[model samples]
Target: MKKIFGIVVVSLFFLSSQVNAQHKIRIACIGNSITYGATLPNPEKDSYPGQLQNMLGDGYEVMNFGVSGKTVIRNGDNSYVSTKKYEEALQSNPDIVTIKLGTNDSRLPYRLKLDSNFIDDYKALIHSFQQLPSKPKVILLLPVSSFLKDSERQTDEVIVNQVIPKIRQVAYEEKLEMIDLHSITADKESLFPDKLHPSVLGETILAKRIYESVVSKKKMDFDIFSKIKEEKKNSSFYGYDCVDFIFKGRNCKVVKPRFSASGLPWVWRARFFGIEPQADIALLDRGFHLVYCDVAELFGNQEAIDCWNAFYEKMHGAGLSKKVCLEGFSRGGIYVYRWAVTNPKKVACIYADAPVLDLKSWPGGKGKSKGSQEVWEIFKKDFGLSSEEAAMDFKGNPIDLVPQIVKAGFPMLHVVGDADDVVPVDENTKIFEERVKALGGNIMVIHKQDVKHHPHSLKNPQPIVDFILHSVKF
Candidate 1:
């Protein structure tokens, strides 16, 4: 009887351990009442985490470890660190962890007084997760917007002006993955009927967005410099790998660097290959990748933009930066500008060298300088425009689209030759600069005296590098 009892005890213990390891991935969601699915109908069944678990399918286990009105800051009214849920989360031994505990922290008196304490305490919370045995992949979430009448107690302004910046700082400082939940909820005011918490439909949106961000990223071991020697030997491109892949039935190329920066920042080079490529080489040396999508003859039509858009999405999924620094030389300016205008949010900044801003000015030869007759015909064909229509439609040019560019609001830098005949500066950069500034847009133009369109980039390439580094924070 004693032997039988001992065997049964051992069997039960083994079964318990086996059950714990059954799920391939375990997720622990740590947050305040918002994360607890506050105000949602049947929160346990329809909360963001619950919905996420359903989306992630049966291979994962998601546990919500949220406490009502808990602040990420330890000294707040009800600190999350002091909660039983925090202890429970620590014991959960999760593979992935999401921290979304700043909504209540946006409430006073913590709201007014958080300062650096929020960052320090948030870092500590992240450290706690990092030290866990599972070594979870930690993602921090910014708080959803607030809309209270007595805004001082729970103000969206304070959250945006104070809390959100600090959370971004933390993400940068820690090099961790971050989700801007505030932006997700900004326009969806109806989702928060009570002014703070999200409804069921809102929760569904939040879950889907988070799911996309997580799953879209490949999550492979990113080797900064993996196969340089082999690529160089095969493609004859020195110090870079010219990767050929098909996008929308068109053969495309992604010029990859052996080693790349932390956030995977890259410059999408537009038009021309060998004109003062010093800046690109310098950026590559500093761990930035350079890419080129061959749509040279297409100009900047809708089809070309669509093709580049596909490339952007693919590279972003392949772990390149979500935002790209667009570098356009000569006629390439139209490509970068048009693409940036169409997908404003995806651009870091624009760097143009002797750019052909106006199609009528460059290809049509209707301005102070003579244009390319062969290229002009191709442009007409691509745009489906007759000569009369092309001459009249300055509206499609970058110069005429200052309002849209200003609306997009990405920084612009142009290097121009004051004495150039081909792609004349006065007809392109001069007008663009004047109009952009008048419209309260950000543009910096560098003029080269007695220089023409022959020399493209700066000899040093330092200024261009500095501008891009500043814009992307690489």
Candidate 2:
């Protein structure tokens, strides 16, 4: 009798181990139409969650619990919590949850006073998942950008101004990892033909980014994981998180302050969105919000100007400071000056470093160094002008607008490399500085004696930060 009992016990233990080994990691993807595979050829097999499941392979089960036209805000038009799918999702016993619900909430008839309950409702939803026996890891997703205006139904303006900010605040407060869906999908206009939903290609990209974010944790070797763990802990102490949005089909990101600064000053960064973070991070700590619009390869033409105008209006409507201090690096010079020259009253000051003031110099490739033929082609295509037309059109270039910029009485600061051959100082900033000085404008140029355009900002960004703080007077 004892031997028989021992055999049964050992068999039961083996069966339990096998069952545990076969248990898959379950991911619950909860959201609205986009997650429902709206406008897709086949939502069931091609939705972002569907594609994500394939990427995650046989080890994971990704369930799509997306409800159509639902809002995360409980008081809004169609509250996600009120939906049957929300209950279904909770019952799935998921080990991970990804919430992507802000897009629908941004639509009209739903968003009326929706901002008030967004945080509390979002927290409640997260808490519901957290209270589960599995205690799933929750990841919040910022909604994708809207390419066209649908004021009667959906407007990206609200998403950019209201939804995204509240979502960021929730992520920061809850100490959860938030993904920048807006930034990744903002430039892929073709992927969203109807201007709202993602195509098959769009779903693929979304799935890939999500998969990368998930597997990045497991794939990290022991050494790298330890290093990252330490850095992440350190970052929590000194770092302020950034909320990214899509403004007029352009990617715009804002880093909020823990403590509000006086008058709410913001610095607008141009070109190379997240390359150098020392200055922007410092400014965030000092209670200044940092913003960026990805108008890459446009070279600041009329099209770029119009897009930026829309973004500025949205920000202003959202109660951002009236006058934005502009920070331009490399080719960003043109974007800075064009906007300022067109709307001088909207600009407080300008800080341009290794700026390409002339299209004919860098992108146009007409000057000292071997310029970018790729950029030159893009430049002409953007302006709808031939080489000769672009050359004749000095009206569009920043170099010709120096007198107007100077007359506007906005203080200017330029940090340039004297030895720079690409975007030669003689052709760009040197000439602008001389022209501005001749026109009796307030301009300051810091010459990095032996440096080239490669190293953009100062190692110690104190001077740059000081210039911005003084200019904004925050």
Pairs that collide in candidate 2 are none
Per-residue lDDT of 299-367 in model 2, one digit per residue for the tens? 788888898898787666565689998988998999899889888999989999899988888877777
lDDT assessment of candidate 1: 0.79
After superposition, candidate 2 runs with Cα above 4 Å error: 1-238, 389-393
Clashing pairs in 1: 225-258
Q: Highest TM-score among the candidates is held by which one?
A: 1
TM-score per candidate, in order?
0.52, 0.51
Among these predictions, the greatest lDDT belongs to 1
Evaluate all candidate structures by whole-model CA lDDT and list the values in order: 0.79, 0.79
